[model samples]
Structures are given as structure tokens and as C-alpha cells.
Target: MGAGHGHRLHYHGHSRLHRAPAHLKLVALVGFMLVVVATPRELYPVFGGYALLLVAVIASTGVPFGYIGKRMVVEVPFVLFAVLMPFVATGPRTEVLGLSLSEPGLLAAWGLLAKATIGVAASLTLAATTEPLDLLRGLQRLRVPDLIVQIMAFMVRYLDVVTAEMGRMLTGMRSRGCDPRSPRHWPLLARSVGALFIRSYERGERVHLAMLSRGYDGTFRL
Candidate 1:
């Protein structure tokens, strides 16, 4: 993949995975996830096999497990939802650790967690090895909608900018002795978010105008 944007998830490397075609990696990712989703929840050992495949790919990429582990926090919500399944879902009960959990729900929870973890890991692996611009170009190669691809391209390009803006806003709030996370100051936080959105929208307009001035033709040329 040709270098373009510096991404937090992208590891700078010259490994074979980094050298692989982005469109092919995207295809393989889709295919791998399909197999994972299709597998029966009761086939516990098979899920382990899927995990081993991911581990092997990850190892070959030369990216540290710790580097990948940090980004795995994105899956916390899925983990939480999976943990609640056995407690709330309707099914025959089984006692384990002195707590009664629904038998079927346990299986469902395992399947959900396993699939979600594998999917996220696979995606992060791709992100670590492929440049953001290359990934977008790959989507274009796969015939995804031009408009959607354009949106994704812009989002990836400007994500760090938006994040920096948010950080500044939070710092400004703190300097004013306002707690952004506290319930009492939530109104201030809400207004800050609205203000941020308007600012970002205006910035986008200016960027579009600048691009048009430079003879941008709607399609990304690389």
C-alpha cells in the first residue's frame, strides 16, 4: 500500500502483510468473518481454530500483541452485552459458581463474544498493516458507492483534526472550572458539542471550496 496518511492503528512496517494487496485483504477479511458467523455456537473448538488462524496472521504482520490489545478496548460494549445475555435471556437454567444462568444463553453469549472479538481483531490487523488511503482505494476497487467512499475518505483524513478540536474544547471547559463529565455541567457539555458540530461543518465547507478551487473532480486520484 502506498503511504498517504499517518494513522494510530497503522504500524509502520515492511512485512509481507503490509505488501499484500488491500482489495485482496478486504476480500479475505469478509470471507473469514462469514465463516466465523456461519459456524455453530456449540462448536467451541472450531472457534479456537479460527482464533489460531487470526493469531498466525497477526504474528506474521510483525505487530505487537500489546499494540493490538490496546485497540481491543473498542469491543468492550460487545463484551458487556455478551456478559448480560446469560443473566437476562430466556432458557433452561444451569447452576455454575452458585449462580443460575440460562444454558442456551451461555452458548449464545460465547458465540457473540467470540465472533465479535475475532471480527474486531481481524479489522484491527488490516488497519495496522494497510494505509487508510489504501483501504479507501480498495473499497473503490470493490465497487462500493462513490459517495460513501468519498465520505469515508474525508472522515479518515479529518478524524485527527476533529479529535484535536474536541480536546481543545474540553480543555477550555476545564479552564472555566466546568466539569464536562459531571451531570450538573452536562448542559455546558451539550452546548459545546453543538458548537463543535457547527464549527466542523463550516470547516468542511471551507475545505470543499478549497478543493474545488484546486480542480478536485469528485473522484479520488492517487
Candidate 2:
């Protein structure tokens, strides 16, 4: 009913950050995430510092706040699960706000939330600012096996095609009064899943045949 989301990454004005080599940027991003993920959960100050650091980087990129906020929605499930820990976790039970809260558990929950938020923010920033081609080039430079890089490149390239095909198949079923949401549709759901598998297999075979006709080999030469 409205404009769809953009999967392709875009570049913006020439900035110092944009001028940096992809490999170096990727390494720094990875390291930052690891630090946030590994830090002790009870260390709120450390987490706050990490969050501020990420905010600084995000500000440096000049990306819109709305974009980062929208992407952070991806962390909701993790945050919810972390929220549940305080109630179920075994530890010194303390009453807070007229509810039983595990002291250690509260710390654990906050830790997970902080880490997840920081991690998502970092990933979103990297993804929003860098082009996929540059990301692949970075991977290649980092000694990621050539074959793996090629597979990733192809997957990213064809992901839209595959998703569209699957969506069409789902739509056809829906049009025929097949309600996937209903519990009684389990059998139909299973069949549809099986059909999807067959379709994917056939698609792969046809693609292989086409590649063979073009004198292709197992190795994907860049």
C-alpha cells in the first residue's frame, strides 16, 4: 500500500569516514561490538560509555536519527527476552516496586539490553554507510576464502529474486482461500513448504544448467 523498504545501501557526501578503507572500518566495527558484548553486565558506566561512543560515530556519519531508530527495532525481541530474566533468574531475591526482582538478574537483564542496543546500532551504522560491493571487497582483503565471498555476493544479488518468487507462491495460495494463519491449515502449510523446496531445487538446477552452457565451472571466478 506504500513505498517498500530499501535493501540496497547508498553512499553520501564525501566524508573522512567514507574515505577510510572498508577493511579497516569493518575491523573497527567488529572490535567495538565485541567490546560491548564482552563487558560485564553490572558495569553500567562502561555500557554508557560504549553507547556514547556509538552515538559519536553515528553523528560523525551525518545519518538521520530516524533511520537508526527504525533499525534498532530489530533488537526488540532480544530486549524482551532480557527483560524476562529478572523474574525467572535464580539469585538473591529483592523486592523492588512491590515485585520480586533478582538483584543479579536485574543487572543481567540491563547488561543484555545495553549490549544488544549498542550492537544493533553499530551494525546499522556500518550497513547504512557502506555499499555491499565495498563490503565484499573488504571481506576479500581480510582473507575470507574467495569461494565464500563469491557465494555471499551471489546470495545478496539473488536474494530479492528468491524472496519475490516465494511471495508470489504464498499469494497464490492465499487467493485460493488457503489461510496460513488458521490452525487447520497445517497440512496445507506443510504442502506449501514442500512445494517451495521443490521450486527452489528446480530453480537451482536450471541455473546450474545455464551456467554449464556458458562454460562455467564449480569455482566462481571473480
Candidate 3:
């Protein structure tokens, strides 16, 4: 639609990775992730191989390390969950550094962390090289259902709009002396979230009606 509308994650580049067809990149990502997921956790050396492969891809793409690192913060929550697995999992115990831990949990945690990190890194690399609209086009070309593709497209297109709306709502709250960090303002913050959801839902309904009026026919013209 717009020049920069669907290029938020795309880095301007003339590298071979950037020039590769979007559908091919999508297939490569899926195949690589599938292999990573299928590998056994106990195969530590294999995991190392996956890491090295991703490193080579990153090096080839010419995406800055700092940009990838910053985007990777989104995976921190999953990492934290994996970190707790060793402490909470019940299984055979092992001693390490003077502390007893579940052996299976340790292996599981390592697998989770390794697979997750590699997957996110690969995804980030793909997004950096391909525009958002190109991703949708790739999915369509790959025979994904039209309805699912359109849903994903709309979600990506309006994410910025929803985020900006939430920002403005928070600004309004702040101007009225509401401090979200204070416990007393927790309810206000919760209400704001609910209000934002309702507004977004109503907006979606309006957009749907407008689309129907224009003969959208439940499919995007690519």
C-alpha cells in the first residue's frame, strides 16, 4: 500500500539474501526450524551445528548484529521460563556446583533455550531481508489458505495503528495524573487495556463492514 507501510522489519540491503525470492526464504526458514525441532536435546553437538549455520546466514545477510540483538529481547520471557525448568522439574537428580538439580530438566531446558534462540534468530534474519507484505505473498504462493493469509496481513497492517492508539490512551491517563507504576493505579491500567480492546474490536467491525461494501469478497487481490 504505502512506501514504508509494510517494511518495518525489512533492512534496506542489496545482498543476495535480500534479493532471494520471498517464498524460497520462507521455505528455507520452515525447513531449518523443522530440523532444529526434530533434533534430540541430548545431541549437543548437533545444536552447535545449527548455531553455526545460523551464524553463517546472518553473516551473509549483512544485517547488523546490534539490530538482531535488540529484536531478540522478545524471546527473553521464554528464556526465563526455560531457566526455571531445572529448578521445578521432577525427575532424576544430579549434583552440579554443590546443588542438586533434575537431570532431565537440565536437558529439557538446554533444548528449549537452544531451539528457541536459533528459531528467533532465523526469523529475525528473514524479516530483516523480506518485507511484511512479501511474507504474506510468500505464504499465499506456498498454498496457505486465503482467509488465514488475509488475517495475518490485517494484523500486521494494523498493529502500528493499535500500538499508537494505546500510546495516546496512556498519554491521556498520564495527563489526568494516573501513574501506572503505582499499585493504586493498577485498576485504571487494567481498565485502559480493556477499553483499548473494545475500541480495537469496534474498529475491526467497522473495517469489515466497509470492506464488504466495497466487494472485498473475503480475499485479497495480490
lDDT tens digits by residue: candidate 2, 27-121: 99999887777888877788788878888887888877777887678899998899899999998999988999998888888888887888888
lDDT of 2: 0.80
Ordered from best to worst TM-score, the candidate numbers read 3, 1, 2
The TM-scores of all predictions, comma-separated, are 0.88, 0.82, 0.90
| Model 1 residue pairs with clashes | none
Q: What is the C-alpha lDDT of each candidate?
A: 0.91, 0.80, 0.89
Best by lDDT: 1
Which ranges in model 2 have alpha carbons more than 4 Å from their true place?
1-13, 173-198
Candidate numbers sorted by lDDT from highest down: 1, 3, 2
Instruction: Give lDDT tens digits, candidate 3, residues 64-88.
Output: 9888889999899999999899889
The parts of candidate 3 lying over 4 Å away from their true place are 1-6, 181-187, 217-222
Candidate 3 vs. truth: CA RMSD? 2.4
> Worst lDDT window (10 residues) for model 1?
1-10
Q: What lDDT does candidate 1 reach at residue 10?
A: 95
Q: lDDT tens digits, residues 1-222, model 1?
A: 223457889998989999999999999999999999999988999999999999999999899999999999999999999999999989799999999999888988998999999999999999999999999989999999988998998899788888789888899878988767769888888888899999999999999999999999777675
Residue pairs in collision within model 2? none
What is the alpha-carbon lDDT of model 1 when measured against the actual structure? 0.91
Candidate 1 segments exceeding 4 Å error: 1-5, 179-191, 209-222
lDDT of 3 at 162: 89
